[model samples]
Target: MNSTHRKALINKLGKERYRTLINNDSFPSLPNDIKEAGLLKKQSNLDQVSHTSESKSRQISPTCAEIKSQQSSHLGAVDFASASTYEMNLESEVVQADVVHEQNPNYVSGNSLTFGDISVPISSCHPYQGFTKPDLRYPQGDDQEDSNITDAQEVFEHASLDGIAAIFKGLVCGAIRTTSPLADGLKPSKASVTTVFPPWGAVDCLLSLDICEASVEPLAAALFNATVKWAEKSLHIGFAGGASLTIPNSEVTLKGVRDEAIAQVFGSEIQQAIQQSRIRIQEMEKGKLTTDCVSMIITEKGAFISLSLGLVQGLEIQKKLYT
Candidate 1:
């Protein structure tokens, strides 16, 4: 189909699916523009608050043998200054030890292969390249056993997105203090915003959203569309069974001028991607689900599945119902 027609089909599909999704909710749905704006605002606020309290990551502690299994709890008021920092003593003799070879260049011994000094001409061999080029095949002695013998083909593939992810993570963490908004009751500083959602709060906030369960699909569809550009080229998106989404990209590139340009150019595509991927939305009238919210199951044309709830906690509930 023509690009315009294809876009129209996508819009039609999204609207039909979204309408169906809203019908499942007891609350009415808001106009598309309004819903988008609210989500954007919430996302912005979440980003700000998340950056402020950045260190509260979930930690895993392990107990072994007879020791009691300890349930992990969030610790308050961590002692930031109590950490002990040390410098490396690179010049110490222990650190400076190196291998020494006593064999002479011209020495040729009789027991070359059986047990005595085997003098090989130095001119026939190239010099070794530092510590990394270890001669693993050298028969040292009876104690020298080949410890590792795994095939090289088993090594997993790597991607360039790894660098991109690092850069994105750094930007979010590094710029957290600057990009926050300044307004009434709050200046646009990072710390003020952080009090609400600490750093990396997006994951938590998303999980907490009580979309009617139907709109989750649209949200996933949008996010999928947004993120799939890299996956389309780098790795296969795999979905093996019931409701799973996996995008094997090194990182989601959403930062700086490059990120901004991408968003500007591909905003609609991203949104549509999310809309198209949704598979199911929970019904609201059953009262089993939350109001003014829609959860959607987004699918990747048989590749994978993810959930996307509405923009805010109860936005669909707050809007008017359209029978």
Candidate 2:
């Protein structure tokens, strides 16, 4: 280019544009002349961007409007007027709290169940002294001493004792069946409780007893004769004793029905035995009794307990058999 052409170009462009062209940075950082020319185009682009952003802001989320419309539709569809009588009543009725269980009659309720033991006052006096008793040891005997009891005597004694026991048991049963409340030794019937039904209870129930035999004259004499040989044979007295409780109303017998319950201490067999023991007053046999050597005690308790102590020494037995 010539100096004249360059001069004319510089005169066409401004001083600032001329200076910017002289500095010359890069393609994007254009010269002032080109930048000024494109300003209106750039402003048009900015206006398009602003319009796109405004359109986006004006648009609502897809879900929000739909959700609101759905909520209003649901509210309109509710069957508030079509509610059933039962549901309406239930809603109108008063709500009550849960009921508590009732207390037990047999025990304390709403309290601790722990129990404590009771302490009793003890005697402060000195402990009781042991009884001053005489020496109860048996005397020393000869080692060569032999028993004098024979086999025949032992057999006889056993049979007699067994017979006595059987009769005694039967007699008690018979008394239970035959003995009347009037004749029995029990006290007057009083207010009592019946165990038959506990829930529907009764206060009065009858209680009675019977005294089988008060006179033990035969028993004593028989005991004596039985144990006479024991003293002569063995040093130890022949002792055999035990206790038993017999309930009443054990046997059932009827002539019309021709029925009879098997009985432990009844029937014709037992009755025959009783007849043998039941001797007339004139025919009653009496045996000699030694007060010192013989000791007897018999006790009765309300037809329930019977205790007998039949102690007969050799001398007592001899007296009954011989004298």
Candidate 3:
């Protein structure tokens, strides 16, 4: 359809999906204007307080292992400052001693396998771009001693997951401070959001949100809805999802010297692209271009989804949702 129709469709779908999202008590609440699918950003005094405390995040942690070690050692009565300083020097050396490849460009990591000297491996966790896929299969012969072989995909997935975990933990803990509807009274944390969720899409929604202004609940809930819909619909590579923001009408206006001239021009190619997406274009009234907003709401069995893009001030959801 035309850009006007396409924009209208986007506004309609965003509101509809969001409506079905927020009826649950667990989600953050928003004002009624959110029903219109207007994605505006909101700033509050609570948000500023959260930021001031976040600067000290690095000091917020005593890992479980550290706590257990301290308890086991019975060092609560001992002078920790002196003991820690001495122990830290030794531990620092041990941690630093693990470093390799400092000078040797051809150094191979223990997790990596290389053929002879050139950087090719029979099986490598790090696959070279554009090279043949690493052979992950191993012989299953029982005529001799049996040995285990690592699954390449599993190895890589685990390694990648460590990084995603750190990111998710930060997002969750940070959100607890900012948006949980009970954050200010709650103490800050130096941990991730929730691992209770699958976490497959945590990075996706977090990356889309503005950390300075965005809270954890709305985007996190959006992520949950997106993932749940992804599974329920059995969608692969994905379905129809796109969004557009409203720009000031003056953006299209020419330098009208005291109403001397006025015009609105936009790329017709965008309109052509939408029409090409198999959407019907029954009517394209020019005034509808300025109307810019419409919305729809879908309900699940005994569940409703309420979305508030406007509540997320300075929120920017990309046009394409990539798998």
Candidate 4:
């Protein structure tokens, strides 16, 4: 049969049945043209399937691109929201910091202002007030008034030469009486001495003494004899006199006598001068006197006393008397 005819028959019988018929030799073998037509038909079907698949892929491309664009836009919106949140948090923190700054008194935000070690705020500062001067003068208080009243009741009198001579005589007798028994291996002696005073007073008397025994060391004996001679000369020189009672063989030394003897001898006169000065101050304070000066000059044959009343101004009565 012709190729066109066989192809038509093969299509009608189907390929498997046709091939079975040809193999049984019940039909003629298939021609190249028919086989080629079969191959061409299969190729056309594959091409159609490939074309449909390409159409499906082309149709899905726009939807995929739309989804990707939607996703990108959603992510951008989320990022913008997060950024806005961060900005809000930062603004809130800044606001809180401002509130905290406002609460503190010492917190200064602008130009730093300082005074010494202190941080000063310009807004809260005021004009500097000058320092107040202290009240350094003496207080005329109730205690001072009471003291003045008490002093007013007492008699104020200047030191007298006669009164001082009597005091000196009593003190000398007391000293000799107390020291005589203590001066062991020594004899009580008497020496007539003259001590010229400053223009204040003058005195002449027989000075008492306790002389060392003849068994004393030669050096001590010579010193005692020399001191006795020097005492006479010193007393004659007035202001330069160093007259003191000597009690040998006693525990007390000549150095102690030089340091304390003048003060001990004139202690009473010093106390009297101090009392008189206080009375004078009391009088001045009560407006009973015109002058605030108090001058006390106590003098004896062997000692001199001069007291300064300058320290009494501030109500401090200090002992500035020197012998």
Candidate 5:
């Protein structure tokens, strides 16, 4: 508590210790001493802080604006490079598409060119025109299809005749009977049957012809007329046509058989005559077929040939009675 004791205590402490205590601001009893110590320590701490902050600021000195401007420059160069590459790719694609379009407009397998108006493509070299395929059987008219039927019928008739004619002529009439105008129906000759083999007595005859008259009718008429003419020439018996010289329907009488013999023996000559006559008849009977109709009848007994003839166009039936 005295000044001497305080002086002794101050001497015991070293000068460095005293300075450390003052700098630390440990003794705050005297206001002036406390103020002076605090001021010295504050000044030293400020100098150290300023030195550290100056070093740190120098290390990270670039401003925010400067950093942003550098980034923008690099990004702009990258963008420009990418844009140039994209434009090149786009132009190449356009050129390739145009070339492909020019080379193959339709893109069809056979032909490259396309028909604008139509859906289907046409070949450059067409093998066929107008029609897809042609039919040779029926050429012209639609109704000509029926002509095939007629042709087939004729062929069948000829085949039938060929098969049976040989057997029929040799066998049916053993004695080989010829025409006898004076004889009546199927009179059996006292002739004995010697041959038992076929074709000696078996006979088949068929007649087929196309006429305005019914199918059987025309055949019968032609055969009848032929028989009558044969009898007149062979027997030297000239009788009136429809009178005594009568040939029944389909019945090969003794006289009628004679005519068929003449026809068969002299076939080529007879056929030629008939063909020539037919041509003349065709010319004469052109429009007459439709207007003045004539019918040829073929019957089981014999054939009939008849024609319609009227001297006066409009006359009563009784007016033309025989006087």
Candidate 6:
């Protein structure tokens, strides 16, 4: 504690160390060996931390790859399921269409079955063939005549009028014979009358008389004129009343006849009724009536009259009976 001993310690230690030692501070200057050892320990800890971080990052890379692979597999499964469902739906639709087509043969492709009015396909209708009455003799004459009569009877039994024109012709003939005066007066001359079938499919009745004073030609001619007048008065009341009597109802009745004929030909399996009415109203308005021709030929023979009638009126009423 002498001044000399204190001055000697201060000189050995240095002024800053002396001040720290005097203050009794905890932090003191370390030796070089101890400081170097502490620095080495800190550097070793830093290296270990860096190596652990790299190892964790390496482990996380594999886990991320596995997660991405699972996500891609899930997406592929979903896409396959969607495609299968779409294909199943498409197949179901095709099967339904095939079933519908098999159920209805009349349902033509690209055409739907409609209950409303539709156009009639005239081309599809049967072609017209005129009526032909069998030639038969009541009493058997020779063997040949008997054979001929048998053949005629067979033909008559099998004959069928399958066309609109033939049906209309038969209607007119039946109506005139049943209701007109022409039938009564012309019965006597029926034996001598020649029936001609024109190439144009028209029926012509030709009557020729002898030039005798007692000949019934005048009465026949008078009866013929009277028959025409009767037809005009009775049938043409609401129809066209000129040489051509075209009744609007004629086509309608003919259509009904067509239905019946179709039924008979195609059987009950097919629909007998036409779904649509194909009436040509424009033809009616244009005054294009059905044609009928009557011609008189005066020659060495007494008198000749040929009558051809087409589309007679009042046939609609008769159609109801047959239908």
Best by lDDT: 4
Better of 2 and 5 by lDDT: 5
Model 1 TM-score, all chains together: 0.14
lDDT score at residue 149, model 1, on the 0-100 scale: 20
Residue-wise C-alpha lDDT for candidate 6, range 1-323, written one tens digit per residue: 55556445544443221022233345343344344445545655665565446435433233444444454566432222112111011111110122323222121222221111222232332111221333466865589675664464310011112222233332122211121235557522112223222222223211121122223233222323211112332322122233433332221111112233323332232211111111222333555332113233333223343333222221221232223
Rank ordering of all candidates by lDDT, starting from the highest:
4, 5, 6, 2, 1, 3
Off by over 4 Å in 1: 1-106, 110-184, 189-215, 221-323
Candidate 6 TM-score over all chains jointly: 0.17
* lDDT digits (tens) for residues 4-76 of candidate 2: 5644554454322212223334423324445554553455456546545643553435544444454456654
TM-score of each: 0.14, 0.13, 0.12, 0.15, 0.15, 0.17
Task: Determine the C-alpha RMSD for candidate 2 after optimal superposition of all C-alphas.
Answer: 39.9
Alpha-carbon error at 290 in model 3, in Å? Answer: 28
lDDT of 3 by residue, 32-95 (tens): 4354333522222343345336434423233534543554566333222222211111111111
Candidate 3: where is the Cα deviation over 4 Å? 1-138, 141-173, 176-217, 224-323
Per-residue lDDT for 112-170 in model 4, tens only? 33332234443453222222344579879988776765565422222223333443432
**Deviation in angstroms for 301 in model 1?**
25
Residue 67 shift from truth in candidate 3, angstroms: 73
Candidate 4 structure, TM-score to reference:
0.15
Lowest-lDDT window of 10 residues in candidate 1? Answer: 190-199
lDDT of 3: 0.25
lDDT tens per residue, model 5, 1-323:
45555444444432222134323345324434445456556654675465346435434223433543444565432222112111011111111111223222221134322111122223432211122333457556746655654454311111122222332232121212122333764542221111111111111111222222122322323333332332332321123374444443233322221234324432333222322333223534663212111223333423332222221210121121111
